[model samples]
Target: MERPSSNGDCYLSLHNFKQGGLVYRDYLFTKDSLMVFNSFGDGPISQSTGAREYYFFPRKNVIPQFSWNSSDRRLEVTATDGNVVFFDYETTAMTAASNLLAK
Candidate 1:
């Protein structure tokens, strides 16, 4: 079966399978590109990218540096004021203010 397209001011649910997973498409920081995080049974599964490193600043942890290691596939949240939090990308949940970056 085919799904009907939205004419103009129509809206679709975030969980709409036809339109794809929940989209943060217009999310402020995500304006550059679409960053889709796959939610696992428990929560977020993992983040995948072909880059050397990625960085971010979780809304709650926005105080030193937010960087990730692509080789090891890890996520690091840091503050500009010098606070830091680290986690393995393949094993951590998505942060509230997480921002994706290129190598």
Candidate 2:
């Protein structure tokens, strides 16, 4: 939300917040996959977040795509290897609750 760098280059850190832990994020960019994380203070804690990942598929014949199944409240992804992955989301209201109930 803020930039705490001296030269105003680091766009990840907070303005006045001095965070000394790991931070990372992953999102689908224009490329196949792109993610970045940076650690400003303390030792190299960024590595603790997770290992960096990169995925690139040949755009010749394989077309990896994603679609949202609104009826099932899921986002399905078809990979280049013909593998399929579905991410189901909870769209119910707070009062409606979810399958996870308290003991």
Candidate 3:
């Protein structure tokens, strides 16, 4: 939550909070995957399958939450019953990918 960089840009960091917990995140730019670990011990992490198309897919107990595209900052995911959801970092939020998918 705190931006340690003086440039004031959107960046990521892992630091310890006063409450005695670790917040960590790994941005795998190569795989276009992200692993976020919060204090609650439940993580929505990204795992690499090394597939050329989707590259990687996130799964928790056989449910894929998100997919990654390294070429473009896009995340192709599926919701309940294979409902497709996409997220593009080029803009912001899921709406960005929705726009691209809509087009």
Instruction: List per-prediction Cα lDDT, in the order shown.
Output: 0.34, 0.37, 0.36
Q: Say which prediction, candidate 1 or candidate 2, comes out ahead on lDDT.
A: 2
- lDDT tens digits by residue: candidate 1, 23-95: 3221111201222333323334344212122234333322233466798676554433233434445435333
Local distance difference test, candidate 3: 0.36
Candidate 2 lDDT for residue 95? 22
Each model's RMSD to truth, in Å? 14.8, 12.8, 14.6
| Candidate numbers, best lDDT first, in rank order | 2, 3, 1
| Top-TM-score structure, candidate number | 2
TM-score of each candidate?
Answer: 0.26, 0.36, 0.28
Tens-digit per-residue lDDT, 3-103, candidate 3: 32465333322222333333332221112223333333344434322212222233222333455677877666543233444555443234332311211
* Cα-based lDDT at residue 22, candidate 2: 42
Worst 10 residues of 3 by lDDT: 24-33
lDDT of 2: 0.37
**Residue 29 miss distance in model 1 (angstroms):** 15
